[model samples]
Target: MKALCRDCFWTGDEQPRRCPSCGSMRVVRHEELGVLGIAHLDCDAFYASVEKRDRPELRDVPLIVGGGVRGVVTTCCYIARMSGVRSAMPMFRARKLCPQATILKPDFQKYRTESRRIFDKVRDLTPLVQGLSLDEAWMDLSGTERLHGAPPAVTLARLQADIEADVGITVSIGLAPNKFLAKIASDLDKPRGFSVIGAAEATAFLATRPVGILPGVGPVMVQSLEKSGYRTVGDIARADLRDLADRFGQHGLHLHRLANGQDSRSVNPNEARKTISAETTFNEDLNRAEDLEDQLWPLCEKVARQLRAEGIAGRVAHLKLRRPDFQIVTRRRTLPVPTQTAKTLFAVARELLAAEPKGQPYRLIGAGLSDFVDGQEAGADFFAEGERRALKGEKAVDILRAKFGKGAVVTGRALKKE
Candidate 1:
């Protein structure tokens, strides 16, 4: 088919100046739109958009969804972006940029509800959806043509419309041969967009773009590549494999592959979440050991609850602290075995925290788990005896919390925080 009308779902053999059927100019044309299957979908300004959706008065107003004066901007609406506010900008800086913009604390429960509704529609199309974040994901529609009775592009276009109509939010979509190129295409346009990049022109299309466009090419890597006389992706694409490997080792070869539009990673539905964590900024910088421990317990409970809920356990426990001046410190310990127990999480995290300098003030505190494993391992014969008991103990608490409310049971240490 020559083009797609995003509004009316029209397809034909000739690309028209406007969608012939609807006469709407929101038409997309690409040579490989019919055959490509791997795609990336990203919700536009998700947090802010949800806020606007429920509060119609805020539809045209600038909205920022985040935390307190000391916190960072979680996200802001497009209208706020026009005034120079952006995600992760310091709250003070964001206020300076858009003084008139309304600021609301993040309502994650509401956001998650909306996210589930949106992805339920996506899962109805294909089960091969891999979430990159709450608002971003990679999708494989390779074999779904038979089920959907249309090409992936047409299916995705309808999906996009369905999201706007059903979920009251807009999403951008990128269709391409692989994950890397699809991700790049998703960002080529903003708000509500659909773009495509085919294998035939991938190299030439990426040639002039900066090396930083490739994944993992941060500021430091960009500086190193430029100093090595490699400025554009074309430079990396044309460089010899032996030369790249010799100069930068395995990472150089990885860069070369991406510059040439090669990404072998699949859209894996079961891809593990890398980490689960919870943290809180203090009202006052805390120096007392007792006060810090009080703060730490609640966070441990939060992380453990999520880990168990997701049916996963972590092989490592992590402790994080931020000093008053914003220098962050993170400490992690490899566990004897994976655990989803609050007792295990707190025990390991407490040891890591205690190792910090005595009476040192901290502006924030947190606990986390990583290096995930299946939660079923807790029942394995080889699983440690102590962790198994700890798991059982927590399961009792989980049962109580589920029956009553989260506040039905709480640790003495957490009560101290209360």
Candidate 2:
């Protein structure tokens, strides 16, 4: 299939303005479309889109999802973007740019629920799915044409349509010969876009793009490359490989390969994350340890819930505090046995928090668990009977919360006021 209409799923070689079957102009045509399998699927303005989906009244209005005035924006709708509001911009600045925009605080639980539904649909198409975040993922649909009775492109098109129908959100898809080009192609057209990059055009397409477009090339590295007269991918493509290797070591070699549109990395489903944490930026700065501890309880519960959901346990419990001046202080403690229960996580994190200098006002508090192992590998008997009973009670609370809602049972510490 050299051409497919995204709306009707019609296949042919003819390039037309609209699909003959459905009369929709959403057509995707490519020379290597039928053969290439690697794809990147990115939900458009994920958090904002979910908000718009739930509250259709805000569909046309500009929306920004973020924290308080002192916090940064997590994401914004296209309407807000047209007014120069961007992710990571301070909420105060975003409000200034889009004065009429509606600002909503992030509801991560809702977002995660929607993300899980979307991912389930994706997994139905292919098992080789690598999730990058709640909004984006890389899918390897290689060697599945016979099973699906269609090429990867057609399956991907159908998947996009299915997600929109089932999840009430739009997605952009990129199909290419490799992971690198696929990711880049996905961003070429946005909101509800389908883009393709063939092996024959990868090098030429990458050469004209800025070096910053390459993955892992951050602002600091861009500045360094610009100082060396390397601004575009083509500049690196034309540079001496030996000189680049000598200057930047292995990283330079890696960049050189990517500059030439060569990426050998596979879409591994077993890619492990480095850390899992939950943090909250308070609307008002908290000074007293009691107030901080009250806030800390919920965050600890969140991290524990995530660990249980992922079937992982951690050997280290971490505490993080951001002072009113934005300076951050971090503390960590290693446990003799790994755990996925909030009781242990909170106990360790509370100890770490107590060790910090008291009376210093903090604007943010975070809890994290790291140095992971499979949940089954965690030694539960490390705690005495009473402690174990408390842990079991927490697990029971988790079940009730899942069956009912998050408010099914509230811990005394969480409800305690400073």
Model 1, 1-418: lDDT tens digits are 7678998999887788799898999988887877899999999999999999999999998999988776779999999999999898878899999999999998877998899998988999999999988899999999888899988999999999999999999999999999999999998898899999999999999999999999998998999999998999999999999989998999999999999999999999999888899888776789998888888888888898888888988988999999989889999999888888878888998888889999899988989999998899753547488888888988999999899998898877777788
C-alpha lDDT values of all predictions: 0.90, 0.88
Q: How many steric clashes does model 1 contain?
A: 0
Return the top candidate by TM-score: 1
TM-score of each: 0.93, 0.90
TM-score: model 2 vs. ground truth: 0.90
lDDT of 2 at 1: 69
Candidate 2 overall lDDT versus native? 0.88
lDDT value, residue 131 of candidate 1: 92
Off by over 4 Å in 1: 379-386
Model 1, CA-based lDDT? 0.90
lDDT per residue as tens, model 2, 186-299: 999998999999988887888878899988899999999989989999999888989898888989989999888889999987887667898888888998888888888888
